[model samples]
Target: MPHNTIRTARCAALVGPYLAGKTTLLESLLFAAGAISRKGSVRDGNSVGDSAPEAKARKMSTEVNAASFEYLGERWSILDCPGSVELACESQNALMAADLAVVVAEAAPDKAVLLAPLFKFLDDRRIPHILFINKIDTLGDQSVRAVVSAYQEVSTRKLVLRAVPMREKGVVTGLVDLVSERAWRFNPHKPSNPVSLPDALKTDESEARQALLESIADFDDALLEKLLEDMAPDSDAVYDSLAQELANDQIVPVFFGSAENDNGVRRLLKALRHEGPEVAVTAARVDAPAQGAVAVQIVKTQIGSHAGKLSLARVWRGEVADGMILGGERVSGVFRLFGHEQTKIPTATAGDLVALGRLDKAATGDRLTDANGGKGNLGAPADWPERPAPVYGLALHAENRNDDVKLSSAIQKLTEEDPSLVLEQASDTGELVLWGQGDIHLRIAMDRLRGKFNVAVKGQAPQIPYQESIRKGTSHHARYKRQTGGHGQFADIQIDIRPLPRGSGIQFEDAVVGGSVPRQYIGSVEAGIRDAAARGPLGFPVVDFAVTLTGGQFHPVDSSDMAFKTAARQAIAEALPACEPVLLEPLLTVTIAVPSAFTPKIQRLVSGRRGQLMGFDARPGWPGWDEVKASLPQADMQDLIVELRSLSLGVGTYVWEFDRLQEAVGRAADRAVEIRREVLAAQ
Candidate 1:
């Protein structure tokens, strides 16, 4: 009982897998706390969370939604986070600022695997968390044992069941508090009414209560003594011990509820009020000053039409006020966020999550402190979540060519807002490519470009940097003669083209004798040869070949660098067809990561994509996981991440780099060439 856990405000995050009902639970909690008079349904697009238009259209949470409420004279900020693996960075960033995280899970054994990665993150950071088994109303004789057992396998810490579901005729109707030994009946959309314990569950309840006591006793020697001597522990003592243990992240208390029915939300809130850790403990963990200074961390940023830039931040310590100069930027406004609505708060103090208006330079993941004497932040940035590597990519272009500059500016703003959004100007293809976590992640980014910035853009799979080179060698001679109005252009060059080994790239050699081609024009000839090799007869960049300027004659007065360059270009272009041009496709050495259970499937997936297996080993630092290495064709990597997630319960990912170029043959080469020709013709 460190200060009995009573702070003016506390922040909690709702995190779970997609469609696990976190958004629904947010509405229920707001209702239970009396923050709203009526609850709104997500299906109707009226819920407080998921208020963004992108979320509404997709019927899923595309970002983090922060809402504040008052319960029993205490203030709380609940961050409802997106559950898709594509947006896990949002949840990870918000979690670093939270005092406790409520892991909302479905009450089904099959869906337990989805919690593994999330649980590991929380435990590794020592963040206090609780398990609320949601949607219990869908249960028919809900096997609490089956659900708990399934979750236990993934959780490294212990799980203590705080309540047992009360069932009648194979249908769960209510819950019996294991700590208080009191039974309550669900009254849908209202407060649960107290009821006497049923006789049939008395024995089952006794065993469950005993198990709960033992789990808590493991962390308390005194409690262990009491349990060892067969002496019953007092309910009040049990509550205090459970609260302390939860604060330390030693255990996760389990509760059963149906947010759709508001069945156990009140009881869950009660547990939070008593068990959530105080602000001081968390402020120390984040290295925020204990007192006398303002320290805030920006978790999310947004662009508003009228209000301008909005920075959603958690006040770590001290008071933040409007017009105050912090980190060299004046705060335009300080307000609390409630979905689309903002309440103007004069000054936000410690433990408050607020939206600061128009802090121009303060970006997400930035720790801004007002006390550091012009240093800006708290000496060093706090522990921030890293932006995940981009797994999916598309070449983007403005639909209207006139909007090209505007589109680039809009994309810059979007990338600044979300670091996970990556923009790359492809050097080989000259395409503006946007990379993100998945197809839907980039889709939302593009939607914002259109909806918010009024720029319409089209996306397509980025083209592979395919190259072509000569498989055989040929020698040719050519001359350029152009009569201008005054001086005539005349140049002659004899060159030899030869195939180099793989990875040799394009090379230029000078073997001219006795200044036949002047030193000044020799470089121009090589440049011209490279330009001609850019697009061979195969319509791709050429590589892995060498060209030698054997002998060339240039007139001192008539031949300029341009004349020699033209002659060199003509010689290579004519010789390329005779030298037998071949198409060379790029290859990538991709390392696929997944749980060992899915190793076989990963192997099959690689083989199906014409990938050559390079063996697999246990992923470093990750137990029960394997990293499979393979060399795959660049064309086949477009949708590989999508299929990896599908096969591995949305947790698999891969990283790849250009390995080498191999000659393309058969239908693959013919199809690619045909497509390239059609594209060139259309242009």
Candidate 2:
């Protein structure tokens, strides 16, 4: 092995769109590295990356899975990330610690757009990555060139195709290495068998090789000069230039493979082993000093049923050892993880990703440097992307009343595992609401709550924050008299109520001209009126109104604050209905973001949802995207993201805040009242 290939730890991340075969690629890589004697299939629920119970049940990854092994004396750790957009945060955190990323994608050209967001993230962070087009054998009708072209449309980096598939009667049976100028036939369970260049593929292969050279030469002036001078560069020079440019994130090398059959697995491993940057280089890239006190950054956190809390961290400087202190907590243990299993290790050096047991204070994306013989500094870089806003929510309550107390702590742990989820106590509705990226994201969270945390919850769509306000004003006189025995209660009051402008919350004042009502009892009467305002005849909290206490009579011998409070309550109950109460629904000023090409569709979407369009313009800082501002009823926003994404190829999103409350009249108001009645009845 070369000196650069000396035994050193490096991390790679596997990420892409849902069902892009990232898990399968991880298996193939492990098998090729001799870490696994037999590759387990996802269909069998035995793949190393998706070993969690939740993942097995859904046949998808629910969190980041770490697997480490040694190949040819070099240590390697690969993080298999969830492919669903709902779980993109997991992939992003893992990517921060990666020396390189292998973005696995489908071979079809039309589906290439699915990689846009991932590509943008890598490009923005200047994270070195390679595109591995998996399942090439399944590409019966698609041309590699067409797929490459489509990918290039979204990718900011120059793409260099490293190899061309060698087809036999329209079937991809092998591929020709462009740099080596050699051809090989794929062997299902072993390294590809070398073959002579086929006569029919000669022209296509030569053209593809030339294109690869040109793409790489664009970043290498010496190679560009050599190419312009019509002088061929040696394969060593070409490989050297390729590695250099890739380390700098100037270009993305494209490799094709069929992970299911293990073809191309060995070649990909060789490339990663030889070309991936070293730990020292990664430290320099992130501006972290190459030598310093031990520093570790937690990329993922998992609370295993038996293992307790584990913080998966990447050592950026120095070494981490069991019993070392991090973030004011002792590192209880250190272990190397492979799927669900782990091997206890006493120490981990720089560039090594190991799980530190019982780092309860640690969280994903937190950086901890050695401090006073313990870990410290729990901050991520300022440039890290903010968490995505929630687009869906559910009102959840424990199925069993006894689990109510446990539910909050269970959900806290759940959100800890996946920070994309949010939990809130909706003050308007008094219901516990769980917010997430989509229905799937919330479903998985609920599953964990029940299966792992033992808290079963019943869930439903969140209630809209509907309100009610009076349209007119009225005055009422009320009396409370009770003569059951000694000190019989006697009180009388007159109050005036009136409507205020929209969004003006309930107000109370005393307009009394004399002490017909004692000043101390006046406060008690106002309290009664405000309490009455809590519920309107329309079955919601009343707002945008005021109540004035004009006059009241109280018998000094027989009257108490309770008696006056009851009289005031009766006054409000009778006065509000005659004031013509109207229901008010929350209106959100939503800014819908979508590709410019879908602006017309978004306009139609807004209109169809009973929304008023404020206008639209190009989205700031996002190329080829538009932001359509509109005011929509909160009821209409429940499924708006779903519809918008459907129309925008799953790239659309929006941000919204409560703009105002608009009066709801006619059948809409009646329907809302009926729904509220039904929900209360069910509760």
Candidate 3:
């Protein structure tokens, strides 16, 4: 029976690892809802989610995409999030606004490990999710139970299988709903056809139904009592328990489907319509206001060259009207987004995820309220997903120097859309470095630079910020006596140089007596020595050394700041070569979080990269995972994330910070110095 009346909109975020068929499932879901005439394929570059040129070029989602549809008189807005691990934060932002989440996964048992991070995040947040084992047609005689059991290892929430597969010889032909115990055969691109239960599956279905009942009974005392008394609980009672437990995020319902063929999509939609939590439940979960106060949380922001600033937000309470004053910024337009198409709406209420036009001051994760007392009132939740730390960086240069201003503006807009991107001007390297989660992430940004912003740019590995320090030091006396004109330059200085402890930095002092050097000229001598330290004999910043002026002579007529400064620099220049200056590279204290099974591989990878292992322990609050701490050289840490993900099934991640500097004394040091010299020559 279909609902006869229209209802309010609900939002769901489709999330999973890369290649999990989320985009394909989006197409099928829209087709089943009669929102689209035909399904678009991701490979064909025609899918609604692949509207961006960057996404189409790679045939993968580069960012969060929004789609809306109506089914059975109930409207829905689906947030189609990127699946790559590098873009996990993008999914987190969208999930914060959704009423529920559909965790799509491939039906491969070995790939279950890939869900650990996402499962931990969802479980930690108590977000209600359904595990949909997609591409079941590719199961290849493997039972869905195996896949479910594999996933159960990673998820803390109880997983309740909703259906049991029915196979013909070795191939799955249909499935039986555990609650209804009704068999239905799949019809491609259409509704499943009901069929009588096969005799062979009767016992299987009975066992599965009992399991489902028992799982839900754990949360319902009445159901538990009925089961204990050998009484068969009604299907309605089972469904009610399932809905209640799911709303409370106590369990994860499991379903299987081949979304590419449009099989089982209707059942998923029906389940959502019947079991999904209301906007009130989500509002309470996120601590949204209880009253009719207008508030919206900006989950994602998209800045278009033509569309201008579009803030995709969820209306958590009250109604937001076009031209309403929110946080002192007038909402220019209220739009319901469908990929690239935006339909102008007069208003949006709670649970509606729409794009607001021209809220320039608004940013992602801002909760805008109607508290406009002439001052903006945008509150950000503490649980707002922290932007992932940059694990990769590239020195970005405009292909045409004339486009430098445009490049920076475009990059700023890109950062607004994806907060994970970080732009920095390196003090040591003097390069405009852009930091991100990985190379692919930075590549996507570069693509958008050329494709979306029409700004030409190029990228390369950023230069390492390496410093040079002295192991030994000696003193030298320098004299600047240039008799070029009537005013001849004449200054002499005797300085004692000695290496201080590491991290002591470059220091300068004077111990001259008898006022041999004028008081004003002493400051110039110190400045010149500091300036000389900026570019040492090794062509890098010098550190952990000190210089003291023992005695000096000067001609008052010509010995100005410039003469003293020149003589001080000359003294240091002559003293540095004999001081045994050594190359020093920065080391980072890295803490890597990964499944325990990959800890050994991580250790080996670190060891291969000149990393010294500190220790490893179970990750706090995350079961079955380990946090491995190590000290790695900054030069070797560049591609560590890339290799770590390759070794850990794409789930390994780490945080790193500068710990200290270490002396380099091998071929690696020589190679680094060689590269530095070459780079300097080029410049």
**Worst 10-residue lDDT window, candidate 1:** 374-383
Best by TM-score: 3
Per-residue error (Å), model 1, residue 499? 1.5
lDDT of 3 by residue, 143-184 (tens): 888999999999999999999987887877788998888899
What are the models' TM-scores? 0.97, 0.96, 0.98
Q: Per-residue lDDT for 550-572 in model 1, tens only?
A: 99898878998888888988988
Which segments of model 1 are wrong by more than 4 Å?
A: 1-7, 289-292, 378-382
Identify the runs in model 3 with alpha carbons over 4 angstroms from their true place.
Answer: 1-5, 290-292, 372-376
lDDT of each: 0.88, 0.87, 0.89
Give the per-residue Cα lDDT of candidate 3 at 245: 91
lDDT tens per residue, model 2, 1-683 = 43245468999999998899999999999999889999998889999989988899999998899999888988999999999877888899889899989999888887766787889899888899999999999989678888888898879899889898988778888889999989989999788999999998899998998998899999899999999998999999999998999899999999998999998878889889888888788777876632238888788888865569988988888888898777678899999999989889888988889999998888877778777556466577665567888888988999999999999988888888777888999998888999988877888888888888888898999989899998899888999999987899888998888899986798888888779999889878987887887778877888998888889898989988888888878788888889899999999999988768789998799989889999999987666678999999998888787898789777788888988999998777899999988877796
Cα lDDT over the full model 2: 0.87
Of 1 and 3, the candidate ahead on lDDT is: 3
Candidate 2 is scored at a TM of 0.96
lDDT of 3: 0.89
